[model samples]
Target: MSSLRETVPWQEEPDDGTDGPVVPSRDGAAEDIRLFDGAMDPAREEGLLAGLELLGADAARGAQLDFELLRGWQQHVLHTPQPSAFRNLPAFAKKGRERYGIAPDTRARLDACLAESSTAGGRSLPLAARAARACLDVCFFHPFEDGNARSAFLTLLFVLAREGVALNDVGLLRRITFQATDPQDALILARYFDAHLAETRRGAACPGS
Candidate 1:
Protein backbone atom coordinates (compact mmCIF):
# COMPACT_ATOMS: atom_id res chain seq x y z
CA MET A 1 0.00 0.00 0.00
CA SER A 2 1.08 3.56 -0.66
CA SER A 3 2.26 5.43 2.38
CA LEU A 4 0.89 8.79 3.41
CA ARG A 5 1.84 11.76 1.29
CA GLU A 6 1.34 15.45 2.10
CA THR A 7 0.84 18.46 -0.11
CA VAL A 8 1.93 21.97 0.80
CA PRO A 9 1.51 25.34 -0.81
CA TRP A 10 4.52 26.24 -2.87
CA GLN A 11 5.46 29.72 -3.85
CA GLU A 12 8.26 30.34 -6.26
CA GLU A 13 10.28 29.00 -3.28
CA PRO A 14 11.42 32.01 -1.36
CA ASP A 15 14.91 32.59 -0.04
CA ASP A 16 16.11 30.31 2.77
CA GLY A 17 17.58 31.56 6.08
CA THR A 18 18.57 30.02 9.37
CA ASP A 19 21.39 24.86 18.16
CA GLY A 20 22.44 24.02 21.42
CA PRO A 21 22.83 24.22 25.26
CA VAL A 22 21.52 22.54 28.44
CA VAL A 23 22.85 19.24 27.01
CA PRO A 24 25.71 17.29 28.48
CA SER A 25 29.00 17.80 26.67
CA ARG A 26 30.67 14.83 24.97
CA ASP A 27 32.95 15.74 22.05
CA GLY A 28 33.61 19.31 23.10
CA ALA A 29 31.95 20.70 20.00
CA ALA A 30 29.90 23.86 20.35
CA GLU A 31 27.28 23.48 23.04
CA ASP A 32 24.35 25.76 22.09
CA ILE A 33 23.18 27.99 19.28
CA ARG A 34 19.89 29.20 17.89
CA LEU A 35 18.38 27.19 15.06
CA PHE A 36 16.14 30.16 14.36
CA ASP A 37 16.85 33.80 14.97
CA GLY A 38 13.63 34.85 16.63
CA ALA A 39 12.16 33.73 19.92
CA MET A 40 11.36 30.05 20.44
CA ASP A 41 9.84 27.82 23.07
CA PRO A 42 12.65 27.33 25.55
CA ALA A 43 11.69 23.86 26.76
CA ARG A 44 11.11 22.42 23.32
CA GLU A 45 14.30 23.99 22.04
CA GLU A 46 16.25 22.53 24.94
CA GLY A 47 14.89 19.08 24.27
CA LEU A 48 15.84 19.34 20.61
CA LEU A 49 19.40 20.21 21.52
CA ALA A 50 19.70 17.43 24.03
CA GLY A 51 18.34 14.97 21.53
CA LEU A 52 20.75 16.16 18.87
CA GLU A 53 23.65 15.71 21.23
CA LEU A 54 22.56 12.15 21.91
CA LEU A 55 22.27 11.48 18.19
CA GLY A 56 25.57 13.20 17.52
CA ALA A 57 27.33 11.04 20.00
CA ASP A 58 26.07 7.96 18.27
CA ALA A 59 27.23 9.30 14.93
CA ALA A 60 30.63 10.14 16.40
CA ARG A 61 31.07 6.63 17.71
CA GLY A 62 30.19 5.00 14.37
CA ALA A 63 27.14 3.33 15.79
CA GLN A 64 24.61 1.91 13.39
CA LEU A 65 21.16 3.50 13.41
CA ASP A 66 18.03 1.44 13.95
CA PHE A 67 14.52 1.83 15.27
CA GLU A 68 15.62 1.50 18.86
CA LEU A 69 18.15 4.29 18.42
CA LEU A 70 15.48 6.40 16.80
CA ARG A 71 13.18 5.82 19.75
CA GLY A 72 15.96 6.85 22.07
CA TRP A 73 16.32 10.05 20.14
CA GLN A 74 12.58 10.67 20.27
CA GLN A 75 12.48 10.10 24.01
CA HIS A 76 15.26 12.63 24.47
CA VAL A 77 13.49 15.10 22.23
CA LEU A 78 10.41 14.81 24.41
CA HIS A 79 12.54 14.51 27.56
CA THR A 80 10.36 11.56 28.48
CA PRO A 81 12.81 8.66 27.88
CA GLN A 82 10.53 5.73 27.28
CA PRO A 83 10.90 2.24 25.88
CA SER A 84 10.60 1.61 22.16
CA ALA A 85 7.14 1.77 20.65
CA PHE A 86 5.79 2.71 17.25
CA ARG A 87 2.55 4.59 16.77
CA ASN A 88 -0.37 2.42 17.71
CA LEU A 89 -3.09 4.17 15.73
CA PRO A 90 -3.67 6.29 12.68
CA ALA A 91 -2.07 9.65 13.18
CA PHE A 92 -2.54 12.93 11.38
CA ALA A 93 0.71 14.57 10.44
CA LYS A 94 2.26 17.44 8.43
CA LYS A 95 0.02 20.19 9.70
CA GLY A 96 -2.80 17.66 9.49
CA ARG A 97 -2.49 17.42 5.72
CA GLU A 98 -2.34 13.64 5.80
CA ARG A 99 -3.13 10.73 8.04
CA TYR A 100 -0.49 8.09 8.60
CA GLY A 101 -2.37 4.82 8.42
CA ILE A 102 -1.68 2.24 11.02
CA ALA A 103 0.37 -0.55 9.56
CA PRO A 104 0.90 -4.00 11.04
CA ASP A 105 4.59 -4.08 10.05
CA THR A 106 5.60 -0.49 10.69
CA ARG A 107 8.44 -1.37 13.03
CA ALA A 108 10.02 -3.70 10.52
CA ARG A 109 9.53 -1.18 7.73
CA LEU A 110 11.11 1.63 9.70
CA ASP A 111 14.02 -0.57 10.63
CA ALA A 112 14.48 -1.44 6.96
CA CYS A 113 14.59 2.21 6.04
CA LEU A 114 17.19 2.87 8.70
CA ALA A 115 19.26 -0.04 7.52
CA GLU A 116 18.97 1.08 3.93
CA SER A 117 19.91 4.61 4.86
CA SER A 118 23.16 3.44 6.40
CA THR A 119 24.35 1.73 3.24
CA ALA A 120 28.11 1.45 2.70
CA GLY A 121 28.84 4.36 4.98
CA GLY A 122 27.01 6.37 2.33
CA ARG A 123 29.53 5.70 -0.46
CA SER A 124 26.94 5.23 -3.21
CA LEU A 125 25.96 8.90 -3.33
CA PRO A 126 27.47 12.22 -2.47
CA LEU A 127 27.54 12.78 1.29
CA ALA A 128 24.97 15.54 1.39
CA ALA A 129 22.65 13.69 -0.96
CA ARG A 130 22.66 10.71 1.37
CA ALA A 131 21.82 13.01 4.25
CA ALA A 132 18.96 14.66 2.35
CA ARG A 133 17.44 11.31 1.44
CA ALA A 134 17.81 10.05 4.99
CA CYS A 135 15.97 13.13 6.19
CA LEU A 136 13.16 12.40 3.76
CA ASP A 137 12.98 8.76 4.84
CA VAL A 138 12.51 9.68 8.48
CA CYS A 139 10.07 12.42 7.56
CA PHE A 140 7.90 10.10 5.52
CA PHE A 141 8.10 7.13 7.85
CA HIS A 142 6.72 9.11 10.78
CA PRO A 143 7.73 6.30 13.07
CA PHE A 144 7.07 7.80 16.48
CA GLU A 145 3.95 9.09 18.19
CA ASP A 146 5.43 12.57 18.53
CA GLY A 147 8.48 14.55 17.49
CA ASN A 148 8.85 12.97 14.07
CA ALA A 149 10.03 16.24 12.62
CA ARG A 150 12.63 16.54 15.33
CA SER A 151 13.56 12.93 14.67
CA ALA A 152 14.03 13.64 10.99
CA PHE A 153 16.25 16.61 11.79
CA LEU A 154 18.38 14.43 14.02
CA THR A 155 18.70 11.87 11.25
CA LEU A 156 20.04 14.49 8.90
CA LEU A 157 22.65 15.49 11.44
CA PHE A 158 23.54 11.85 12.05
CA VAL A 159 24.05 11.09 8.39
CA LEU A 160 26.15 14.19 7.92
CA ALA A 161 28.30 13.37 10.91
CA ARG A 162 28.76 9.82 9.68
CA GLU A 163 30.30 11.23 6.51
CA GLY A 164 32.36 13.76 8.48
CA VAL A 165 30.44 16.76 7.22
CA ALA A 166 29.45 18.98 10.11
CA LEU A 167 27.42 22.10 9.63
CA ASN A 168 27.92 25.03 11.92
CA ASP A 169 25.13 26.79 10.05
CA VAL A 170 21.79 25.09 9.45
CA GLY A 171 19.96 27.88 7.63
CA LEU A 172 18.78 25.76 4.73
CA LEU A 173 18.18 22.58 6.68
CA ARG A 174 15.89 23.98 9.36
CA ARG A 175 14.17 26.85 7.56
CA ILE A 176 11.72 24.61 5.70
CA THR A 177 9.80 21.37 6.05
CA PHE A 178 9.45 18.37 3.75
CA GLN A 179 6.88 15.65 3.22
CA ALA A 180 7.41 12.18 1.83
CA THR A 181 5.99 12.88 -1.62
CA ASP A 182 7.46 16.28 -2.28
CA PRO A 183 8.65 16.03 -5.85
CA GLN A 184 12.20 17.29 -6.26
CA ASP A 185 12.46 17.67 -2.51
CA ALA A 186 15.55 15.51 -2.30
CA LEU A 187 17.41 17.41 -4.99
CA ILE A 188 16.54 20.77 -3.52
CA LEU A 189 17.66 19.61 -0.07
CA ALA A 190 20.93 18.28 -1.47
CA ARG A 191 21.65 21.66 -3.00
CA TYR A 192 20.94 23.27 0.31
CA PHE A 193 23.37 20.88 2.02
CA ASP A 194 25.94 21.66 -0.61
CA ALA A 195 25.49 25.38 -0.02
CA HIS A 196 25.66 24.96 3.73
CA LEU A 197 28.80 22.87 3.39
CA ALA A 198 30.41 25.40 1.09
CA GLU A 199 29.56 28.28 3.39
CA THR A 200 30.79 26.40 6.43
CA ARG A 201 34.06 25.52 4.72
CA ARG A 202 34.64 29.10 3.61
CA GLY A 203 34.04 30.55 7.06
CA ALA A 204 36.69 28.24 8.54
CA ALA A 205 35.01 28.33 11.94
CA CYS A 206 31.76 27.00 13.34
CA PRO A 207 29.09 29.66 13.00
CA GLY A 208 28.57 29.87 16.74
CA SER A 209 31.90 28.56 17.91
Candidate 2:
Protein backbone atom coordinates (compact mmCIF):
# COMPACT_ATOMS: atom_id res chain seq x y z
CA MET A 1 0.00 0.00 0.00
CA SER A 2 1.46 3.33 -1.05
CA SER A 3 1.56 6.14 1.47
CA LEU A 4 -0.50 9.29 0.87
CA ARG A 5 2.79 11.08 0.56
CA GLU A 6 3.78 8.56 -2.07
CA THR A 7 0.47 8.49 -3.90
CA VAL A 8 -0.13 12.20 -4.31
CA PRO A 9 1.31 13.57 -7.56
CA TRP A 10 3.53 16.65 -7.62
CA GLN A 11 4.33 19.38 -10.13
CA GLU A 12 7.98 19.74 -11.15
CA GLU A 13 8.35 22.22 -13.95
CA PRO A 14 11.21 24.66 -13.71
CA ASP A 15 10.37 28.30 -13.09
CA ASP A 16 9.79 29.96 -16.45
CA GLY A 17 12.39 32.64 -15.75
CA THR A 18 9.59 35.03 -14.97
CA ASP A 19 9.80 37.95 -12.58
CA GLY A 20 7.08 36.66 -10.33
CA PRO A 21 6.97 33.31 -8.56
CA VAL A 22 5.87 30.18 -10.39
CA VAL A 23 2.55 28.91 -9.19
CA PRO A 24 1.67 25.20 -9.23
CA SER A 25 -1.24 23.79 -11.13
CA ARG A 26 -4.36 24.79 -9.26
CA ASP A 27 -6.68 22.12 -7.79
CA GLY A 28 -7.47 18.84 -9.61
CA ALA A 29 -5.46 19.81 -12.61
CA ALA A 30 -2.43 19.18 -10.51
CA GLU A 31 -3.47 15.58 -10.13
CA ASP A 32 -3.56 15.08 -13.88
CA ILE A 33 -0.05 16.36 -14.30
CA ARG A 34 1.35 14.23 -11.54
CA LEU A 35 -0.40 10.87 -11.37
CA PHE A 36 -0.29 8.26 -8.67
CA ASP A 37 -1.99 4.97 -7.94
CA GLY A 38 -3.29 3.30 -4.78
CA ALA A 39 -6.27 3.65 -2.49
CA MET A 40 -5.80 5.15 0.97
CA ASP A 41 -3.84 2.49 2.76
CA PRO A 42 -5.10 1.70 6.22
CA ALA A 43 -1.65 1.41 7.79
CA ARG A 44 -0.52 4.67 6.25
CA GLU A 45 -3.73 6.32 7.32
CA GLU A 46 -3.17 5.03 10.84
CA GLY A 47 0.35 6.42 10.82
CA LEU A 48 -0.89 9.83 9.72
CA LEU A 49 -3.53 9.73 12.43
CA ALA A 50 -0.85 8.88 14.94
CA GLY A 51 1.25 11.79 13.78
CA LEU A 52 -1.71 14.11 14.15
CA GLU A 53 -2.20 12.76 17.64
CA LEU A 54 1.39 13.64 18.48
CA LEU A 55 0.93 17.12 17.13
CA GLY A 56 -2.23 17.45 19.19
CA ALA A 57 -0.37 16.30 22.25
CA ASP A 58 2.34 18.83 21.69
CA ALA A 59 -0.25 21.55 21.37
CA ALA A 60 -1.98 20.36 24.52
CA ARG A 61 1.30 20.48 26.40
CA GLY A 62 1.74 24.06 25.22
CA ALA A 63 5.04 23.15 23.71
CA GLN A 64 6.36 25.70 21.28
CA LEU A 65 6.80 23.52 18.18
CA ASP A 66 8.58 25.94 15.92
CA PHE A 67 9.60 25.83 12.23
CA GLU A 68 12.65 23.73 13.00
CA LEU A 69 10.40 21.09 14.49
CA LEU A 70 8.08 21.38 11.56
CA ARG A 71 11.03 21.00 9.21
CA GLY A 72 12.19 17.88 10.97
CA TRP A 73 8.72 16.41 11.03
CA GLN A 74 8.19 17.17 7.37
CA GLN A 75 11.50 15.57 6.50
CA HIS A 76 10.26 12.41 8.12
CA VAL A 77 6.90 12.56 6.34
CA LEU A 78 7.90 13.04 2.70
CA HIS A 79 10.56 12.07 0.20
CA THR A 80 12.39 14.78 -1.72
CA PRO A 81 10.50 15.99 -4.81
CA GLN A 82 12.08 14.89 -8.09
CA PRO A 83 11.35 14.89 -11.80
CA SER A 84 10.11 11.40 -12.26
CA ALA A 85 7.00 9.39 -13.02
CA PHE A 86 6.22 9.37 -9.35
CA ARG A 87 6.60 12.47 -7.17
CA ASN A 88 9.68 12.41 -5.01
CA LEU A 89 8.80 13.53 -1.51
CA PRO A 90 12.45 13.56 -0.52
CA ALA A 91 13.36 16.01 -3.23
CA PHE A 92 10.55 18.30 -2.22
CA ALA A 93 11.70 17.98 1.36
CA LYS A 94 15.25 18.82 0.36
CA LYS A 95 14.07 21.92 -1.47
CA GLY A 96 12.34 23.01 1.69
CA ARG A 97 15.43 22.24 3.74
CA GLU A 98 17.49 24.49 1.49
CA ARG A 99 15.07 27.37 0.95
CA TYR A 100 13.89 27.73 4.53
CA GLY A 101 17.38 28.87 5.59
CA ILE A 102 18.60 27.82 9.02
CA ALA A 103 18.27 31.19 10.68
CA PRO A 104 16.72 32.24 13.99
CA ASP A 105 14.41 34.70 12.23
CA THR A 106 12.85 31.85 10.26
CA ARG A 107 12.01 30.12 13.48
CA ALA A 108 10.52 33.36 14.77
CA ARG A 109 8.21 33.64 11.80
CA LEU A 110 6.90 30.14 12.37
CA ASP A 111 6.53 30.87 16.05
CA ALA A 112 4.44 33.94 15.32
CA CYS A 113 2.10 31.91 13.15
CA LEU A 114 1.71 29.23 15.77
CA ALA A 115 1.07 31.82 18.44
CA GLU A 116 -1.60 33.53 16.38
CA SER A 117 -3.52 30.32 15.91
CA SER A 118 -3.00 29.05 19.42
CA THR A 119 -3.06 32.10 21.68
CA ALA A 120 -4.80 35.12 20.21
CA GLY A 121 -7.97 33.21 19.32
CA GLY A 122 -9.35 36.05 17.20
CA ARG A 123 -12.75 36.20 15.49
CA SER A 124 -13.80 33.50 13.05
CA LEU A 125 -13.24 35.36 9.81
CA PRO A 126 -9.89 36.82 10.74
CA LEU A 127 -8.70 33.70 12.47
CA ALA A 128 -9.64 31.35 9.68
CA ALA A 129 -8.39 33.83 7.11
CA ARG A 130 -5.08 34.09 8.87
CA ALA A 131 -4.80 30.37 9.22
CA ALA A 132 -5.34 29.88 5.51
CA ARG A 133 -3.10 32.80 4.66
CA ALA A 134 -0.38 31.46 6.87
CA CYS A 135 -0.48 28.13 5.10
CA LEU A 136 0.12 29.87 1.79
CA ASP A 137 2.74 32.17 3.21
CA VAL A 138 4.62 29.31 4.80
CA CYS A 139 4.58 27.38 1.57
CA PHE A 140 5.65 30.47 -0.36
CA PHE A 141 8.40 30.87 2.16
CA HIS A 142 9.28 27.25 1.26
CA PRO A 143 9.97 26.48 4.87
CA PHE A 144 10.48 22.76 4.69
CA GLU A 145 11.17 19.85 2.45
CA ASP A 146 8.72 18.06 0.13
CA GLY A 147 5.60 18.15 2.25
CA ASN A 148 5.50 21.85 3.05
CA ALA A 149 1.99 22.30 1.63
CA ARG A 150 0.82 19.14 3.31
CA SER A 151 2.32 20.29 6.58
CA ALA A 152 0.73 23.67 6.17
CA PHE A 153 -2.64 22.05 5.64
CA LEU A 154 -2.21 19.97 8.73
CA THR A 155 -0.99 22.94 10.74
CA LEU A 156 -3.91 25.09 9.71
CA LEU A 157 -6.28 22.31 10.63
CA PHE A 158 -4.70 22.06 14.05
CA VAL A 159 -4.95 25.79 14.63
CA LEU A 160 -8.59 25.95 13.63
CA ALA A 161 -9.51 22.86 15.61
CA ARG A 162 -7.77 24.23 18.68
CA GLU A 163 -9.52 27.55 18.27
CA GLY A 164 -12.94 25.87 18.63
CA VAL A 165 -13.62 25.80 14.92
CA ALA A 166 -15.37 22.67 13.70
CA LEU A 167 -13.58 21.96 10.49
CA ASN A 168 -15.10 20.23 7.47
CA ASP A 169 -15.04 16.48 7.34
CA VAL A 170 -11.78 14.92 6.15
CA GLY A 171 -13.60 14.13 2.93
CA LEU A 172 -13.69 17.82 2.13
CA LEU A 173 -9.92 18.05 2.35
CA ARG A 174 -9.55 14.98 0.17
CA ARG A 175 -11.91 16.48 -2.33
CA ILE A 176 -9.97 19.71 -2.49
CA THR A 177 -6.81 17.81 -3.32
CA PHE A 178 -8.57 16.15 -6.20
CA GLN A 179 -10.40 19.25 -7.46
CA ALA A 180 -7.90 22.08 -7.24
CA THR A 181 -7.61 24.38 -10.29
CA ASP A 182 -4.45 24.58 -12.34
CA PRO A 183 -1.53 26.98 -11.83
CA GLN A 184 -2.84 28.14 -8.48
CA ASP A 185 -4.12 25.03 -6.81
CA ALA A 186 -2.54 25.92 -3.51
CA LEU A 187 -4.30 29.29 -3.47
CA ILE A 188 -7.58 27.63 -4.34
CA LEU A 189 -7.01 25.12 -1.57
CA ALA A 190 -6.34 27.88 0.95
CA ARG A 191 -9.58 29.61 -0.04
CA TYR A 192 -11.52 26.39 0.31
CA PHE A 193 -10.10 25.79 3.75
CA ASP A 194 -10.92 29.35 4.84
CA ALA A 195 -14.48 29.19 3.53
CA HIS A 196 -15.06 25.85 5.16
CA LEU A 197 -13.84 27.14 8.49
CA ALA A 198 -16.21 30.09 8.20
CA GLU A 199 -19.08 27.77 7.31
CA THR A 200 -18.35 25.62 10.30
CA ARG A 201 -18.45 28.67 12.55
CA ARG A 202 -21.80 29.72 11.10
CA GLY A 203 -23.25 26.30 11.68
CA ALA A 204 -22.02 26.25 15.24
CA ALA A 205 -23.23 29.76 16.04
CA CYS A 206 -26.69 29.55 14.50
CA PRO A 207 -28.07 27.24 17.19
CA GLY A 208 -26.75 29.25 20.12
CA SER A 209 -27.10 32.85 18.91
Candidate 3:
Protein backbone atom coordinates (compact mmCIF):
# COMPACT_ATOMS: atom_id res chain seq x y z
CA MET A 1 0.00 0.00 0.00
CA SER A 2 1.28 3.44 -0.88
CA SER A 3 1.70 5.88 1.97
CA LEU A 4 -0.51 8.99 2.11
CA ARG A 5 2.56 11.24 1.88
CA GLU A 6 3.40 9.72 -1.47
CA THR A 7 0.03 10.47 -2.97
CA VAL A 8 -0.32 12.90 -5.82
CA PRO A 9 -3.41 15.09 -5.95
CA TRP A 10 -5.64 12.69 -4.07
CA GLN A 11 -9.22 13.24 -5.12
CA GLU A 12 -12.44 13.27 -3.10
CA GLU A 13 -15.61 12.06 -4.74
CA PRO A 14 -19.27 12.72 -4.05
CA ASP A 15 -19.92 9.67 -1.86
CA ASP A 16 -22.51 10.69 0.72
CA GLY A 17 -25.35 8.70 -0.84
CA THR A 18 -25.99 11.70 -3.05
CA ASP A 19 -26.89 11.52 -6.74
CA GLY A 20 -24.66 13.97 -8.47
CA PRO A 21 -21.27 14.00 -10.13
CA VAL A 22 -18.54 15.43 -7.93
CA VAL A 23 -18.25 18.99 -8.95
CA PRO A 24 -14.83 20.53 -8.71
CA SER A 25 -15.55 23.04 -5.99
CA ARG A 26 -13.09 25.86 -5.52
CA ASP A 27 -12.53 24.69 -1.92
CA GLY A 28 -10.82 21.33 -2.26
CA ALA A 29 -7.59 20.24 -0.56
CA ALA A 30 -5.29 21.73 -3.17
CA GLU A 31 -7.01 25.07 -2.88
CA ASP A 32 -6.98 24.89 0.90
CA ILE A 33 -3.23 24.17 0.94
CA ARG A 34 -2.59 27.15 -1.33
CA LEU A 35 -4.44 29.44 1.08
CA PHE A 36 -2.78 28.02 4.19
CA ASP A 37 0.71 28.54 2.81
CA GLY A 38 0.30 31.72 0.78
CA ALA A 39 -2.02 33.89 2.83
CA MET A 40 -1.20 32.75 6.34
CA ASP A 41 -2.01 36.07 7.97
CA PRO A 42 -5.71 35.38 8.05
CA ALA A 43 -6.28 38.99 9.02
CA ARG A 44 -4.86 40.07 5.68
CA GLU A 45 -6.58 37.45 3.54
CA GLU A 46 -10.12 36.62 2.52
CA GLY A 47 -12.06 33.42 1.97
CA LEU A 48 -10.53 30.39 3.71
CA LEU A 49 -7.48 32.36 4.80
CA ALA A 50 -9.69 35.03 6.40
CA GLY A 51 -11.74 32.32 7.99
CA LEU A 52 -8.50 30.96 9.44
CA GLU A 53 -8.32 34.16 11.48
CA LEU A 54 -11.78 33.50 12.80
CA LEU A 55 -10.59 30.02 13.74
CA GLY A 56 -7.78 31.56 15.81
CA ALA A 57 -10.18 33.94 17.53
CA ASP A 58 -12.39 31.05 18.56
CA ALA A 59 -9.37 29.03 19.70
CA ALA A 60 -8.30 32.00 21.83
CA ARG A 61 -11.44 31.42 23.89
CA GLY A 62 -10.04 28.07 25.18
CA ALA A 63 -9.65 24.41 24.23
CA GLN A 64 -12.87 22.61 25.00
CA LEU A 65 -13.55 19.70 22.70
CA ASP A 66 -17.11 18.75 21.86
CA PHE A 67 -19.29 18.24 18.81
CA GLU A 68 -20.45 21.86 18.94
CA LEU A 69 -16.90 23.22 19.20
CA LEU A 70 -15.75 21.07 16.31
CA ARG A 71 -18.70 22.22 14.26
CA GLY A 72 -17.97 25.81 15.22
CA TRP A 73 -14.38 25.47 14.03
CA GLN A 74 -15.70 24.01 10.79
CA GLN A 75 -17.91 27.07 10.43
CA HIS A 76 -14.83 29.32 10.51
CA VAL A 77 -12.68 27.28 8.13
CA LEU A 78 -15.67 27.16 5.82
CA HIS A 79 -17.54 30.48 5.67
CA THR A 80 -20.07 29.16 3.17
CA PRO A 81 -23.44 30.69 3.95
CA GLN A 82 -24.58 27.19 4.79
CA PRO A 83 -21.31 25.36 4.98
CA SER A 84 -21.52 21.66 4.17
CA ALA A 85 -22.68 19.95 7.37
CA PHE A 86 -21.65 16.65 8.90
CA ARG A 87 -22.09 13.70 6.61
CA ASN A 88 -25.64 12.50 6.87
CA LEU A 89 -24.64 9.12 5.53
CA PRO A 90 -20.96 8.23 5.04
CA ALA A 91 -17.79 9.81 3.68
CA PHE A 92 -14.55 8.49 2.21
CA ALA A 93 -11.02 9.66 1.50
CA LYS A 94 -8.30 8.74 -1.00
CA LYS A 95 -4.93 9.14 0.67
CA GLY A 96 -2.03 8.42 -1.64
CA ARG A 97 -2.95 5.28 -3.54
CA GLU A 98 -5.09 3.86 -0.75
CA ARG A 99 -8.72 4.57 0.05
CA TYR A 100 -10.20 4.78 3.54
CA GLY A 101 -13.66 3.63 4.49
CA ILE A 102 -15.56 5.75 7.02
CA ALA A 103 -18.08 4.47 9.49
CA PRO A 104 -21.75 5.23 8.96
CA ASP A 105 -22.08 6.23 12.63
CA THR A 106 -19.03 8.43 12.50
CA ARG A 107 -20.93 11.41 13.88
CA ALA A 108 -22.06 9.73 17.07
CA ARG A 109 -18.76 7.94 17.54
CA LEU A 110 -16.82 11.19 17.31
CA ASP A 111 -19.16 12.84 19.83
CA ALA A 112 -18.60 10.05 22.33
CA CYS A 113 -14.84 10.10 21.85
CA LEU A 114 -14.57 13.84 22.35
CA ALA A 115 -16.85 13.79 25.36
CA GLU A 116 -14.84 11.09 27.10
CA SER A 117 -11.45 12.48 26.14
CA SER A 118 -12.19 15.88 27.69
CA THR A 119 -12.52 14.58 31.23
CA ALA A 120 -9.93 13.99 33.98
CA GLY A 121 -9.80 10.32 33.08
CA GLY A 122 -8.62 11.26 29.64
CA ARG A 123 -5.87 13.54 30.91
CA SER A 124 -3.93 10.52 32.15
CA LEU A 125 -2.63 9.89 28.66
CA PRO A 126 0.69 11.47 27.69
CA LEU A 127 0.37 14.90 26.07
CA ALA A 128 1.67 13.99 22.62
CA ALA A 129 -0.20 10.72 22.73
CA ARG A 130 -3.41 12.58 23.42
CA ALA A 131 -2.73 15.01 20.62
CA ALA A 132 -1.96 12.18 18.19
CA ARG A 133 -5.14 10.35 19.13
CA ALA A 134 -7.24 13.45 18.59
CA CYS A 135 -5.51 14.04 15.29
CA LEU A 136 -6.18 10.53 13.98
CA ASP A 137 -9.69 10.43 15.37
CA VAL A 138 -10.60 13.35 13.18
CA CYS A 139 -8.75 11.86 10.26
CA PHE A 140 -10.47 8.46 10.27
CA PHE A 141 -13.89 9.73 11.31
CA HIS A 142 -14.07 12.01 8.27
CA PRO A 143 -16.53 14.35 9.96
CA PHE A 144 -17.23 17.05 7.39
CA GLU A 145 -18.23 16.77 3.77
CA ASP A 146 -15.00 18.64 3.00
CA GLY A 147 -12.06 20.20 4.77
CA ASN A 148 -11.49 17.17 6.99
CA ALA A 149 -7.74 17.72 6.78
CA ARG A 150 -8.04 21.28 7.98
CA SER A 151 -10.43 20.22 10.70
CA ALA A 152 -8.08 17.49 11.88
CA PHE A 153 -5.23 19.99 12.03
CA LEU A 154 -7.34 22.34 14.10
CA THR A 155 -8.27 19.50 16.43
CA LEU A 156 -4.56 19.00 17.23
CA LEU A 157 -4.21 22.68 17.97
CA PHE A 158 -7.16 22.56 20.35
CA VAL A 159 -5.93 19.43 22.12
CA LEU A 160 -2.49 21.01 22.62
CA ALA A 161 -3.99 24.31 23.69
CA ARG A 162 -5.96 22.57 26.44
CA GLU A 163 -2.64 21.29 27.84
CA GLY A 164 -1.00 24.73 27.37
CA VAL A 165 1.28 23.48 24.58
CA ALA A 166 2.40 25.43 21.55
CA LEU A 167 5.00 24.86 18.84
CA ASN A 168 6.95 27.52 16.96
CA ASP A 169 8.24 24.94 14.48
CA VAL A 170 5.11 23.50 12.93
CA GLY A 171 6.75 22.94 9.58
CA LEU A 172 6.82 19.18 10.10
CA LEU A 173 3.23 19.04 11.23
CA ARG A 174 1.79 21.30 8.56
CA ARG A 175 3.47 19.85 5.52
CA ILE A 176 2.79 16.14 5.87
CA THR A 177 -0.23 13.82 5.88
CA PHE A 178 -0.24 10.59 7.86
CA GLN A 179 -1.91 7.29 7.21
CA ALA A 180 -5.08 6.78 9.19
CA THR A 181 -4.38 3.21 10.30
CA ASP A 182 -0.61 3.11 10.77
CA PRO A 183 0.32 2.80 14.45
CA GLN A 184 3.91 3.84 13.74
CA ASP A 185 2.65 7.07 12.20
CA ALA A 186 1.06 7.94 15.54
CA LEU A 187 4.38 7.53 17.35
CA ILE A 188 6.10 9.61 14.72
CA LEU A 189 3.57 12.38 15.19
CA ALA A 190 4.27 12.28 18.92
CA ARG A 191 7.95 12.70 18.20
CA TYR A 192 7.18 15.57 15.86
CA PHE A 193 5.19 17.24 18.60
CA ASP A 194 8.02 16.71 21.10
CA ALA A 195 10.67 18.05 18.76
CA HIS A 196 8.66 21.16 17.97
CA LEU A 197 7.81 21.65 21.62
CA ALA A 198 11.49 21.34 22.59
CA GLU A 199 12.55 23.86 19.97
CA THR A 200 9.88 26.25 21.18
CA ARG A 201 11.08 26.03 24.81
CA ARG A 202 14.78 26.37 23.98
CA GLY A 203 14.27 29.38 21.71
CA ALA A 204 16.37 27.91 18.94
CA ALA A 205 15.87 28.29 15.20
CA CYS A 206 16.96 26.00 12.33
CA PRO A 207 17.96 28.48 9.67
CA GLY A 208 14.62 28.98 7.87
CA SER A 209 12.86 27.92 11.08
Give model 2's clash tally.
Answer: 26
Selected candidate, larger TM-score, 1 vs 3: 1
Q: Name the better of 1 and 2 by TM-score.
A: 1
Q: Write the per-residue lDDT of candidate 3 for residues 1-209, one digit (tens) a residue.
A: 22432232212211222111222212223344455645665532344454444445555675467656777767756666664577765556673444444555656777766654353763344566566667767776777877777777777766665544555556676677777656567667766766666555545334333
Mark the 10 consecutive residues where model 1 has the least summed lDDT: 18-27
Which runs in model 3 stand beyond 4 Å of their true positions?
A: 1-36, 39-63, 95-104, 116-119, 204-209
Residue 187 displacement in candidate 2 (angstroms)? 7.8
Query: lDDT of each structure?
Result: 0.64, 0.43, 0.57
lDDT of 1 by residue, 104-160 (tens): 887677676666556465344456655676677677777778778778888888877
Ranking by lDDT: 1, 3, 2
Tens-place lDDT per residue, model 2, 1-209, is: 01211222222212222211112222222232123111344434443444455556655565554565455445434532421121223232332333333443554555665454444444322443445544554554455534555666556545544543435333344444321113345445545654554454455556334
State model 2's lDDT: 0.43
Model 3 sits at a Cα RMSD from the real structure of 12.7
